[model samples]
Target: MSTPLEANQVEAIQGYDAEKRYKYLVKEVVANREIWILTDEHGCVMLNTDYEDCVPVWPNKEFAESWATGEWEDCKAESISLNKWHSRWTHGLEDDELAVVIFPNQDEDGLVVYPDELDFELKQQARKQNQR
Candidate 1:
């Protein structure tokens, strides 16, 4: 209920500080629509919609390792982009069912979330799922 900078604030700040101080950005998911970037105050930046840039990767030793190390570029160019990957993985899952799944990783906790097609194929099955 106080003063709130509109969308132009971000562009204004950017223009004002193009080569000056860089503000630290804290990105958080909120209300399924608004994106809040916090630093020292509220409404420093606001986005009305969601944004994601994720790349699909298989949850296996050979595949996950290759993706982490950038070895599968030649084979799966489309799936390597973060936008494509995130879209492919959570395509058919319900909103609540789209929770992140972490599998065991040789280096650490699992970091790969793959598409359902690769999932079924890797499981030695032949089922296809579609996005809604």
Candidate 2:
């Protein structure tokens, strides 16, 4: 059973979700207030926001699992890309938790947002090779 406080916290996290995706919560995932730049075992790169539920590359389920299992770190990829629809966000998840927030790319299509820069650049290099 959820205490009043807990219920309020979940409610706060589900703020104004007309689409019901990304929301803020009193329950925070990231133990640190700072952004952590992290690289997964596969070496993919991405910009991670605060410690909350981190957003990792989907389809790459292994990498996502790593972050959830405490095998990764948080780093804010603050490049600031905008979108036409504010409802849709490119959120990375941590464990089974919903994304507390997301990177600024805000695009649900394509590469979405890299959780770290170094890995992203490296993966891009691989993508280029595979394409050719």
Q: State the lDDT of candidate 2 residue by residue for 1-132, as single tens digits.
A: 112235464344334342222111111111111221224455335444454444333211221232343333442222111121111232322223433223122223122322333233333544555577
Candidate 2, residue 8: lDDT? 60
> Would you give me the overall lDDT of model 2?
0.29
In order, candidate lDDTs are 0.27, 0.29
What is candidate 1's lDDT per residue for 1-132, written digit by digit as tens?
Answer: 112335564334324321121111101011111111111123111112133222332222232333333332334211123233335434643342332223222333323233453333322321111211
- Report residue 14 deviation for candidate 1 (angstroms): 36
Listed per candidate, the RMSD to the true structure in angstroms reads 19.3, 16.7
Instruction: Rate residue 28 of model 2 by lDDT.
Output: 15
Q: Which candidate is the best by TM-score?
A: 1
Worst 10 residues of 2 by lDDT: 23-32
Please state the error at residue 99 of candidate 1 in Å. Answer: 3.6
Q: Estimate each model's TM-score.
A: 0.20, 0.19
Model 2 TM-score (2 dp): 0.19
lDDT over C-alpha atoms for residue 75 of model 2: 27
